[model samples]
Target: MESKIILITGATNGIGKAAAKELAKQGHTVIVHGRNKDKTLRVLEEIKAETGNANIDILLGDLFLLSDVKKMADDVKKKYQKLDVLINNAGGTMGKVREATDEGFEKTIVLNLLSPFLLTQSLLPLLSNAPSARIINVSSEMHKFGGKPFFHDFQLEKNYDSVRAYGLSKLYLIWISRHLSAELKPKNITVNTVHPGVSNTNFGLDADRGFFTNLVGKLLMRFSLTAEQGAASLIYLASSDDVEHVTGLYYGPKKKPAEPSDRYYSIENENRVWGYCSQIVAPYMDT
Candidate 1:
């Protein structure tokens, strides 16, 4: 396989880190995104030493803030002319208490959905420059059980639970992925989402989602997949030839196509979500 330039968010730890190392081992130029500069550089060095591939780089940005996301995208455009694969792998659950960023948007939605949407839009030019680009979004199976689409209340201003917020964000991410796949097909960019399975990462462990929820999360971790195991599907989507032309499909940990729940799906709702995200990130689009 030919070399490609790949950027993965939240690559400082967990599944993102695992995926970055594997991709670098495959001789790709891997750009790892992280919020903490020190930790990110440390992980970059670790991956280089372990993979014996020095083509790895790092970019820093907070995914919870759209302005930061835009700046990060600008940094990428300034440094690299083309991007082959972009993995939107940076996302997490919040605490039980509902919180908003300094930009005044809900935390979960911004991190998991809106920021990735904006970042992808901002980097479209770079992605289009590649021969055949891929956009891999890391969604979750929780979208099936935990998502409760209150279309009128996307930000969950009224009823907000951490798990529900995460589920809705992942669900909406799938919707936008499908929407973008069609929009970017002519540009040679294939967009898809994946469920990494229940990984034994620090995913929901730090979140204070109340005593009961936390306990259940811990119990489930005992039987969860390893970070590398969880990242298998992501690695496949990023580099495999089997899915080179596949777009707008959801893949499971088995590295095969899987159906995403469409219980709350409709053309109207999908368009609404897209429009809502575009409006929220409009100010950052040009800058």
Candidate 2:
């Protein structure tokens, strides 16, 4: 495989981390991103040691903040003139109750939806500079659960459930992927979303949840995929020539096109969500 520049967010854990290791092993210039500096560096070194590939690099930022997203983009642009692929793999579910970020958006929505929107928009210049670039978004099948957004209260302001909030965030991301695929098709940049399939990782454990919810989450683990198995689809999208031209589609572990939700395929809903997110991140779209 030819070497390419690849950036993966939330690479310090789970599927993102597994993908980063696989990419690095393939001799690509892998940039691993994480929230903490120490852990980020540790993961970088660990990947280097495990893969025996010294080309791995690190970028640190809190994806929940638009300002931090812009800062991370600026750093990437300063260092590299071209980015062959961008894996928007950094996202997670919030606790039982909804919490707002400093920016006023719900924490779940900000981390999963707005962060990727701003980061991708800001990095478009670099992504466009490459001969052919791909944007792989890590989304979930649960998107169908909350595909119908409460337009009147887009942020789940009135009523908040952690699972639904998570589904809503992933749904928005899949829509953004579809919208961007169309926008960037002329530029030779393919954008796609993948459902990593319930992986056995430290996902819901970090949240402050009730005993019952936690117990259910743990029980579900028995049917979950290992982190490495979960990352197969992501690795395929990022490195497979078979999917090089594939864009604006949802993929499952089978490496085939999968349906997101009947609601998400609606043109009206796509535009509505795009317009809403664009307006919210207007100030950060200067790039």
Candidate 3:
């Protein structure tokens, strides 16, 4: 494989970190994102030492804030002339109650959806500079469990549940992937989403949880896939030749094209959600 400039969001831990190591091992320039300056640097150095690839770099941002996402994008644009691939992998679940970021957007929606939307839109020019660019979104199979999004209330303001919020966010991400795939077709940019399976990573441990819930989550982590294993599908979608031309699709276990829930297939919902996201991120995105 040829060396490429790849940026992965939320790469300080779990599947994102694992994917960064694997890609760097392949001799690609891997730019990883983390929320903390120190942790990001540590992960960056670790990947470099492990892969013997000094090209590894880091970017820090709190995905929940659109401003941070834009700043990160601007930094990338100024530093890299071309971005061969972008992996929107930074996301997590919130607690039982609703939590809003300082920006007023729900934490789950902003981190899992809006951040990627704004980042990708802002960096389209850099992606377009490459011969063929790929956008791999990290979604979840659990999306089916999180009932369809309340299109009217996209924020879950009326009734909020942790599982529901997480599922809706993932589902909406897949929908956005499909919608954007069409939008970028003329540019030869492939956009696809993947389910990393259930990984035994510190995924939701950071969220506030009750004693029982926390215990259950810890015990359940033992039975899931290792972080490296969970990143397999992500690696496939990000660099595989078989999927070079494939877009607007979801890949799950076995790295096969899987169908999302029926709710994600609704054209009406897709258009509405796409327009809504565009409007929300317009101020942060370039004209």
Candidate 3: regions farther than 4 A off? 209-216
**In model 2, which runs have C-alpha deviations exceeding 4 angstroms?**
none
Structure candidate 1, residue pairs in collision: none
Candidate 3 lDDT by residue in tens digits, 1-287: 87889999999999999999999998989999999999999999899889999998888899989999999999999899999999999999888779998889999989998999999999999999999999999999878978857888888888688888888889889988999999999999999999988899989898876677677878878888999998998888887788888999998856887888875568888888899899999999876
Candidate 3 residue 126 C-alpha distance from true site, Å: 0.7
lDDT of 2 by residue, 1-287 (tens): 88999999999999999999999999999999999999999999999999999999999899888888988998998999999999999998888888998888898888999999988988999998988999999999888886457777778999788888888889889988999999999999999999988889888888976789789888887799999988998899999888888889999876777887866468888898899989888887763
| Per-prediction TM-score | 0.98, 0.97, 0.96
Each model's lDDT comes to 0.94, 0.89, 0.90
lDDT of 1 by residue, 1-287 (tens): 98999999999989999999999999999999999999999999999999999899999999989989999999999999999999999999999999999999999999999999999999999999999999999999988866568778888999898989999999999999999999999988999999999999989877899999999999998999999999999999999998899999999997988889989899999999999999889999984
Model 2 deviation from native, Cα RMSD in Å: 1.2
Candidate order by lDDT, highest to lowest? 1, 3, 2
lDDT of 1: 0.94
TM-score pick, better of 1 and 2: 1
- For TM-score, candidate 2 versus 3, the one ahead is 2
C-alpha lDDT of residue 75 in model 1? 99
